[model samples]
Target chain A: MSQNRWAQQTLWGWGRYPRVESLVARPERRKEVLDALADRQGDPVLAFGLGRCYGDAALLREGRVVLTRRLDRMLAFDPETGWLRCEAGVSLEEILHTFVPRGFFPPVVPGTQFVTVGGAIACDIHGKNHHVDGSFADHIRRVELLVADGRVVTCGPDEEPELFWATVGGMGLTGLILSCELQLARIDNPYIEMESIRVENLEQFFEVSAESGHFTHTVSWLDCVTTGKATGRGIFMRGRHAPAGTTGGLSLLSRLGRAAPALINFPVDGPDWMLNQATIKAFNEVYFRKHPKGQVNSIVHYEPFFFPLDAVRNWNRMYGNRGFLQYQFVVPPDPSHKAIRLVLEEITRSGLGSFLAVIKEFGERQHGGISFPAPGPMIALDFGIAGQPLFDLLDRLDRIVLDAGGRIYLGKDSRVPRHVFEQMFPELPKWKAVRDAWDPGHVFQSELGRRLGLSGGQR
Target chain B: MSVLILGATSRIAHELAHRYAENGQSVFVAARDADEAARVAADVGVRTEGTCASGRFDATDFAGHAAFLDSVRETVGPIEVAILAFGDMGDQHASEGDFEAARHVIDVNYTAAVSICELLAASMTERAAGSIVGIASVAGDRGRQSNYIYGSAKGAFALYLQGLRNRLFKSGVHVMTVKLGFVDTRMTYGLKTGIPIAAPDAVSRAIFDAQRGRSDVFYYPHFWRGIMSVVKAIPEAAFKRLSL
Candidate 1:
């Protein structure tokens, strides 16, 4: 039976590239979600969270996109155990707003809190605390997946382990995650005691990063545009959850009332030149110089420490109507952090400086399906779209990463060549095998999936 | 205080249930679909620091109103806030062709609404403390050929709410009528409107705030009040010729 539930609309990833006009259904309840999936009209169906994935990993051209945002609902929460059972559409912001006052937070959150809980698992997202806390999938106790045959299978570490691991970084290809049981981490207070240390050059960055490993969270903001005497200068910031009785902090109750901080919007799309090389370099210079020459200690709210950019609503518009591409890649730990240094040198030499460059270290590697974080140093940069030249630059960087035994984050990739992806992720066959077993029909698909040959029919 | 939301399947009503639940009030979500109601109740229950419950509630079942309400009061406490959010915009064209269709629209939007509300009014008047919010529509301001059937039903409901407010005034029971413009909901699913549609959550917040201020009636997206006033002032001769 045909249903008029699908509305024809245009969808784009957070990068705002490769926009697709697709038939989309925003389901407000579980039954509506099933109904939307069942009446696909012979088109492939993929469930979409908040469309926060920077690339086309969540987009599909002319296909059925089931929007899960409206399905948000918290089924249950055990405050004593820090266990939260919620529908997949619940955003991390909502979770933080509701739980932070109770002295609990998600085990790991990416740079933004706008992403849905399901999106975090789909990407196996990590935060500055990856050195200690790992990624989102590690804290998941169980997930209720709507598989190809339309059965809701309860999978986890013990039960359906293969399916559980596969779904962790499965990019929504394994199945539609309807809801899950997440293990939230307890906090003494809803604040972070942060310290920023100025580091000059790539050598200092790795040294400071290593020394700060014992800290709960650590990351660096790099001046990737600088060359010669000042190359790779940055400020390494580390923080831990503020201990109880920390002076000059609001009581937990007031902080909870102000959990959602007010935001100022980026009113209009900036001109292309707004983020051009010269402007970025100038901004980087001032940013790098603003921090004190020595270490400085401060106390901050979790919102600013973890999700700094989220403070400015629609900040992505600063990259203009075409938007910017966020390129993030990881290289395995090597002698003297050689791989990362070489990559940064190439980035600076290109003269197409990234607007925001951040570096973080991942702890001991964890085994799993296509999860991005491992034992390595990861760097993320945002560059304005400059057409073929930009793609060429990425292609050059791809070879360097491939040679260094590293890989580009699929979540941040919108234009990686198929061959490069194949070489970067040799474990694709294993992930595909699990997909075939669960979704032999290849009913679930995405634009990124088809672009990089991550589907059953492609090869 | 505990709140009861009838016809809670609608997005606005769900948001209303959510707001009350978050405020630490016991919420009862009742709808025509038992499973759907139970699911929403489970969802809303997590937000409340108190308690939440749900039961099957078909507004058209006038015969069962009292028993259903009594069971609800038993599950939750006395209903301090009652909102009637159920209505049918039965296709105007189809409604005109069949009396059953027309009656269905009128029965749910007008008759059934008054039935349960009177039951609520009776108890609220006795308790001498409560608030009732009736979700009417701005379409009720002036009837047009396109949707006069649904419009007229809503018009009667709004008029009924005004009278109810007067009767309950001496008893200190507050009554509020909300004339909503186009809300981002399933009801206005695919329609294109000149003005940006008000979000369901925003509309819910406005109604909640209005009820707190003891507003007898107000238009959602407040600008709708101005637009409706002009439409209401249009002469019947010219209004009849224009399709709305």
Candidate 2:
């Protein structure tokens, strides 16, 4: 390693808000990462992987951030069983590009494929198929973690389950994940038979989701600007892996098509008033009216079906230079649906509508102690960072979500109070106990962990 | 078909290794640091379908250069392209007062480079094929008061490359010297150069293009050629009087 390897850099999450300056060390090897951690630098350190989270979950602020991008490498792969072991820095896109043509795919993939495996595990990210396969942690077989004492330990569901569960969704505060073994799912082809249904309201969305339970993937786009009878009206999409021999010659074309880089990119942030209520309402109206009333069935590549937003690089720049905040929360699966209705009503009444609100149903919760997904209906909305009013509105929405037995996704959150966080995740104490046992000195710390009082005695 | 990159762990060299691998060329990466070399090898291997391997190599260890080349040849076959990218820009102020420091800089930048180049030149000459790319710096064009110690070493290395180029011209061997200006790399991390800095990606692309073209003493980014020409044209009396 060079004598002067650390460089001060400004970093932010994909949301692009709440930027912070940090001393970053890009270690190219496992030994370098270990040496940096053991050097007794006194500054709290966090392992950063691609910085795909929408908030400070991956940011350390004034602390040290060990960038793991250079450590990306495939350690081992079992072609027979489709089990792969790779460094934590390997990205989902890399994995897909290598294995998709070979008839295998990651079981759980979030909206974007640019995230690293470590970041996906840290967030325990859920995807369109969460209602069937659960979150990313469900497919993880084992993980090697570099703890505070510089000891590398192998943990899994049956081995060191406490530490494993805590580290899964621990926001990378427990330790730096060195590597992980994942169970990849075999697929016939890369194409998906997709069905899009235009729903009239929130109730119709629930009905459509329930009807599409047999489908491998399901998600709904919500028009948050619609009021009264048409509130939450939008398009519902369900997809299944295209049957064997259906794609034929098109499979190769699909693979090559997805490999092409995105052509449309938002080079700069739009004006502050670009995503205002008036503009969002107009967009939502046009989007809702654009889709046909009946169900539309089509065969498309999995990339477009699963990661549509990725087709337009830097899509978040549409929110403008001030950046935006992604407020995603999940409410318990209640028959009354009162909680979700109240939240949507509050958003519409605030006169601030997000053109990118998405609603999905989550299945049974995984084993991760702090995992975000549960048996619930979740909603994710993006709002421009317009100051106090936005915070106040989010606070009010948080109360309704809390009353309905819901918690916000930490990966997408930027501003939830400590008390609210504590209330939402009652298992925090258990996660803390496991973390303290692994890292007593609080060596592995981040701004999100600090903000939520998850750093134990150090905070 | 095969490329050998000495000092493969350096930011620019590492990127260049990946570029070659992605282009379907086999890569053999060697560096003084075994762990870093292995990491680069693994990264390049995973990113491309081409064969990749790595070995430990110390530029200052003259005796090890021949053995390193032999090992690479045995592992990945005769290297079609060999890149010399190892050098240190020592602390100029400290080198001015410390003879040992100055000697170390000279040895790394010039002496060690000469030893490796000689061994590589002999092996490639015997094969009657292959290209050698030396990553020299534009600082060698004209010495300045700020960093003459490092600049003088680069100057010597560039002159040596020019001589090697002339010797290898008739042997079917290509010798290309990459004269780089201000590059945004770890070596120039925080130093404000006042010049428009080129990214390592651009520099690596230029190096690849130079190797393919078999160009001798080409300036990276193309514009550096004009800039260095103007600097070299300045009279010594006038150049020494002004702070550059």
Candidate 3:
């Protein structure tokens, strides 16, 4: 059947990138996706698992895009070992529903469970638990890849090491991913033992976040508007799963069940114009007020603990017709103070306000150099592309990132200049070497790849 | 296209710059004060230079009207499309109470625009391909007791634009008079009225649309078309009694 571009406008986790192209093919099976990829005529092929990559990383411009949503199905689960195997299209939401009842949960999640297994592997996505559990790559046991030659290869840390590493954070450039076997973490209950704290300024925020390093998960929202005394005033939320007896009457299984339907498997778009600055300010006030200063919340379920923002539908439209570009990058951990401060100052001076601004500390060693995650302090933001100043503002930001020994996240960028990107990610040659081996014809491509001048050169 | 905008400090003028810039067109924003115009240009991301600063354009300086037109033409170069977003919504009470105040509105709205249009229309007729847009108002449809002094000036400008449209139509140049309703701008901030307010973006979109399509006249909101029709049809005595 022909694909429906209108229906597949957005993937689960990544934001939307409009396609003026004709059809969007939804494949129910891995073979169908592979066949579609194999049969395409010279057009670029992009495998979209769950469109969760923040920007246009998964977007296939004027090309044949394979939608992996219908390929979702659970294949195996080992209750004792917390080992589970599922189709590439299977969502974290689905895994949470099936395993949380049996006392198992994903080791890491990027704020939301609405992303596909294939997507998580493709971007090597990290979550609040990234410092402790690494990324989705750490938990992934093995994955089956359907190469450009239509050959299905099973790869992991021990087998086909190059392809395994390449596919870990390859942005699905290597080939079409079929299924993945991920090792889950053991949890006593579905509820999380959460703690919330209020930070006064940029200095306090860094100290508080570093202090929370002892915890399993930590993240903070910094208000870039205020300067000098009041800069970075916001909330810091940290949490770990609750243990057996400590989480009573919380009905962990019931909470997971209710959350499963509303959250776990698939996420729909939020209502239009639902995230304006006024509304966001109101929400921030309420959120800050509700959580008392330096208070530990006793019981928090899967929904509130993970997917709080997904309660509404079609949230992206709130950015208006101009859409939005999510910008995220990590500054070197050594010069953390200077690097992070410069980033905030750049944003503030640009006079651009972001509805979603997040700052987190990282310990994960640099992956393939070009890969986004590194041992540094990472800051992420989303900006609307409506006005004239935004383009120039982003251009100014690119220079700051380069000067600070930082690199933009490929998975969440739509505007990084081609020259700047090449300079920042020097490990492209290595990734390109692996990409050449798996798909010698260089059939796989994405809008982001072309935009960054990656797909144009030799495989 | 080389476009020169008068009163380029207004929000609608800024939006005009955006529209032209996005389409890869060159624009020059001109204001009464060079510094103010330059600032507006910087904010709107357009090329700005001053030709009419120093309040030398006393529109009532009817003696220097011809010289003012010649100066603008000489400084800005041969403009392809001339947009007049000039004119003040003067204090209605002041205009009603003092004859000098009433004349101030007239000189700016009608006299200056007419003198400029005469010079511009002749140039456009010679070029035989330019467009001139004069922004009038719906208040000109029928004089309201609250703002008759200002409305009468707009009414005169509206008629002048119509005559220019008719004459220029033969010369292959288009003339447009936009009858704007209440716009949510700095100009209308203090007016305690419940009129449907259109954003400057919306107004700019209308102006560009009419310019591209070369329509002779436009009502900014378009709904004001049907509204003013009923308004004009109303009898004057009854209309005056109905506080609108």
Candidate 4:
């Protein structure tokens, strides 16, 4: 390996290796990133956010990888409309910490807080409240995209709408998300008025989540190892931000001003062998016990309610060396919801029961043709790489997803088959048409783009 | 057979899991996060069965080491092979006045591995059929200013692994020591640019080769062996003058 390219050998995701050349840049401003893009005439360029998206979504092979963490800056926030504007490199944690105390919260937030807004927009991340609020893209009012050309272009629903939609879930293939204007939600308090319900199987989970959807936000944690009669057994969590006077009467200002402990390392990178069934089960049991069955508890903090896993620094290292894969997919609302059961069954039969299995209801039609979400039940599970079986099992899952008119989240995928992608995403040609319009040279690309034939020699 | 990888969640450990699972070997990954371990196991095609749980583990939880091993044994059954891949190198200068930093480096490297190996080595000795691999660094051979604090811990581990190998030589249990130079991992991400670094895949392959060949000690990159030998032979008085 060349001396300069050594760092590219591993990324934040499952140990997917990408061979990059000597050129690497950390652009503190959008101009630098765009200038670097212009400097390389033919070589593909990828904008690296917090490097949180699992897999090669941000990796550009033999090309330049632009680190955008330092480009963080908050431009504006309208309290009345809950509209906040900021640079792409600003993380969700920054937003929450800054605005949540000011009576505002991000419309959608993934499980982790380390991800950059650019990454969030690229992934169009959905959270437990996806059934209500949709994705990160849903809240985005406008985006300043640093296109293939050196010029910066503003895109939104009305202006360059196609580019805006494609760039939302485009996985950084279309262009770099330089800055974003997002519509946040007004919150009364920092803590969620949380409630937990135990679901016996897949049927109950769907029933509870649907019923809980009538309220606001809902999510479920399925026991993946539960087999036979108790298959898909787990807990369902439902919540809304507590009213200002409900609990300790904590104000939004107090919560926003509080700073989290300085990040030691990304929790996702914790050593591999840190957790096991007994310990996880115990932790899960405690977590469950903390919120008794149907007990309405008024929690008063954002950290535990939103990012509980963040408490332990470097938690991902717990997975040991094998690393982990996040398999997140959404199925359309079907007649029987058999697709969800089948996917769970497949995971069970494969004997790869993830420790954290999250099931949520997706409320919006997937934006960007090939993006992973639709109007159905979304299931996300964490899997550690045991070898080829994971690939084979995922292929089977892709087949199941495709057959059911479902799609895998490209942001979280590393081994999705090209055929499966082609079958699932019919909008590739249209997006390609728009992308080609912006720059026929195909300057912005990523490993995910290359792997699935979204960009490169074959395409 | 389920292989309980102690440090198996490292880059090399992850690669070993992938290679073994490709050949149909069952893997049990134990790490700090059960979710992450399960994820890795699934990704590598290994079933997260039995004691393949990821939760809080202090490799240097000396008093609890036996209990930890027993817990793993009870959950995952007999570990056919256990590879220790859990050492990290912190900044040497920063560790000078900080006892917590020094202790953390030691705990993660020598103390943690030794604690787990005590139980593993005992079982392997009894079974007379197992292999234990440790990824020690060539920096452990001779200390330097660059990373001597982390290097000292590895030095202790390397010596311990050598002793374990000598003890297990006739017991039919194999213990291999890997004198790794620098593998590009998160630990070395802060290193100055242009440093010679080995890729995770290359280091992983060397690990797999060493495990299969049943070698006691193998220098990764093989070239590191010659380079380290010459470096070690240099007079310390002169070596101290030049910044490493």
Candidate 1 lDDT by residue in tens digits, B1-244: 7899999888899889888888788899999987777767877776555567888999889999999999999989899999999888888999989999999999999999999989999999999999999999998888888899999999999999999999999999999999999898877766667898999989888888898899998898999999999998999988888877
For each candidate, report its DockQ versus the true two-chain complex: 0.53, 0.29, 0.01, 0.01
Write out fnat for all predictions, comma-separated.
Answer: 0.39, 0.19, 0.00, 0.00
Model 2, position A38: C-alpha lDDT score: 68
State the lDDT of candidate 3 residue by residue for A233-344, as single tens digits: 7778788888787654434544564566444323444444555555665665666566667656557776666776554344565565556778888877663477667766
| Model 1 chain B worst lDDT window (10 residues) | B43-52
How big is the RMSD of model 3?
25.1
**Where in model 3 is the C-alpha error above 4 Å?**
A1-14, A18-22, A248-291, A456-459, B1-244
| Worst-scoring 10-residue span by lDDT in model 4 chain A | A1-10
For model 2 the local lDDT of residue A129 reads 93
lDDT of 4 by residue, A1-459 (tens): 111222334344433322234346665433456676766647788888887777778877677787777566565556678877777888888787677667778888877788899999888888877767777788888999888777789999889898887887888877878888898898887778877787777788778777776656778887776677767777787888877776554434334333443443454554544555455656655655565555354564666666766665555566766767778887788868788778878987786657777887888745766566678888888877757887788888888888998788888787787878887777878877777788677787777887787766453
Candidate lDDT (C-alpha), each: 0.86, 0.86, 0.73, 0.73
CA deviation > 4 Å runs, candidate 2: A1-4, A38-40, A243-263, A456-459, B22-24, B182-184, B190-202, B241-244
Q: How big a share of the true inter-chain contacts is recovered in candidate 2?
A: 0.19
CA error at residue A344 for candidate 1, angstroms: 1.5
Model 1 lDDT on a 0 to 1 scale:
0.86
List candidate 4 stretches off by more than 4 Å.
Answer: A1-10, A14-22, A248-296, B1-244
Best by TM-score: 1
Q: What is the interface RMSD of candidate 4, in Å?
A: 15.9
